[model samples]
Target chain A: AQSVAQPEDQVNVAEGNPLTVKCTYSVSGNPYLFWYVQYPNRGLQFLLKYITGDNLVKGSYGFEAEFNKSQTSFHLKKPSALVSDSALYFCAVRDRYYGNNRLAFGKGNQVVVIP
Target chain B: DAGITQSPRYKITETGRQVTLMCHQTWSHSYMFWYRQDLGHGLRLIYYSAAADITDKGEVPDGYVVSRSKTENFPLTLESATRSQTSVYFCASSESSVETQYFGPGTRLLVL
Candidate 1:
């Protein structure tokens, strides 16, 4: 079975502090991972994806994610957290071997940045 | 102004009432998808279309019907609305089978 797991339901951080949101995935073959963010009353926005190549992938809104094949983990990270970065985050995965194009999303994580 | 859009930003309907949600994209993408977002369930797929006439069910397709008569338009219909069906419906489009999906501002529905 292909699936993604977000271990934390909510994470709190102080402004200007570094933050990390953990994600793990299970798949039969190479996994295509993606991160998305949703602000209040807004649709999800694409954050970044790891298909191949570099282990560290950068994305919009000063966010980045690191893909670890050995651990099957793709964790979203930011150097310094901002109050505006507080929102709901989702981790998703797709098995390349299946080639079905459907994604498996984990129950989202809520991040709160306290100023 | 090339992006995905969903009609009826907010809707309120009674039980057993039929409702339709419309989705349109200007990018002419080959793939379109519909998903519902709830409080704790995250986002669940309802249906998708590979092209103008090829449609398929997703993870949670029950109580939902979808038709894609054209490449740019995909409409979802609910034969009988229920309280459990109340959610934020989002429409997304992707250029190909494995690509980044662009989402539209979702439509929030409340069933009483």
Candidate 2:
């Protein structure tokens, strides 16, 4: 079964410092990876996605993710972190071969940006 | 003005009572989905509708019922609500399978 794993339960970083949230996925065929961020009491907001080409994908709010095929990883990164960036991050995977179209999500990682 | 919306932003119900969470999307996307967010579980899909009158089960579908009589509405009903059913439910829609999904504000349900 296709699944995503977020190893870190929490990540604390200083404001203006680079931030990295790790994510790894397992799928039967090509992996369709996505990154989402959620604020308190709010629904998830899409950050980025990796479908086919270009390992590095950019998304909203100065977020970017790199898709690694060999390692089956799609890690979210940002050049500089902000206090507002502190939120819950989720990594999701979708199987490209089958038509089920259900997304498998990771447990999620809470990011804290210390000002 | 054009986005997804969910009804009853917050709800509380007794166990074994039937509760329905409403979801509406103005984008008229071809795909609609229901998911529950828990503390340990990021998000587990409950049901999804490809189009009007076309519905399918997702990862976790038991104890829930859904109907897509119209293209814009996808409501999820818990036949018999349980204490474990307390969760934050989200409704999302996408133009197609590979398209980016847009989510609503979400409805928080608490089963006592």
Candidate 3:
């Protein structure tokens, strides 16, 4: 079964500081991973995705993720955090069984950027 | 609401009642999905369709019903709404199985 894990329930970081939200995945073959952010009373917005090629993939709003196959991790990172960046983050991986593209999401990580 | 839209952004119903959440996508994507968002569960897929008339169950499919006769619309119906079903429901679509999904505003449902 393909799955994803976001160990941290909450991460608090000061504004302008670098931020890192950890995520790990378990899949049989090359996994298709995605990161999304959701604000209050809103839907999830696509941030970035790691399908293949480069290990470091850049995405919307100056966000990026690193895919490490050995570690089975694809962690979301930002050089500088902002108060507006605070939101609920989710990590998802496509289920490999039966060649299904359905995603399996983690418990989600709440990021708080203090001003 | 050009991209994707959900009707009755907020809804309240009673247990044992039938409730349908509407979802519409403009992209005419080949795939559509319905997921429930809970406090600790994040988003759990309820059902998904590869194309019109090709619906399939997802991880948590019990107690839910869906039909996709049209490509642009995929509505979810809770046969008998339960308090446990109270949560935010999201609709998403993608051009293909391997494409990045685009989400709708979501419908917040409360079963009293």
- DockQ winner among the candidates? 3
List where candidate 3 sits over 4 angstroms from the true fold.
A96-99
Tens-digit lDDT track of model 3 for A44-86 = 9999998889999999999999999999999999999999999
lDDT of 1 at B43: 88
Residue-level lDDT of model 3, residues B30-62, one tens digit each, is 999999999888899999999999999998998
Residue-wise lDDT of candidate 1 within B16-105, one digit each (tens)?
A: 999999999999999999999988888888999999999999999999999999999999998999999999999999998789988899
lDDT tens digits, residues B46-108, model 2?
Answer: 999999999999999999999999999999999999999999999999998887788888999
TM-score for each predicted model, relative to the true structure? 0.98, 0.98, 0.97
Candidate 2 stretches with Cα past 4 Å from truth are none
- CA shift of A96, model 1, Å: 0.4
Alpha-carbon local distance difference test for all models: 0.93, 0.93, 0.93
lDDT of 2 by residue, A45-67 (tens): 99999989999999999999999
TM-score of 1: 0.98
Q: Would candidate 1 be rated incorrect, acceptable, medium or high by CAPRI criteria?
A: high
Give the backbone clash total of model 2. 0
The TM-score that candidate 3 achieves is 0.97
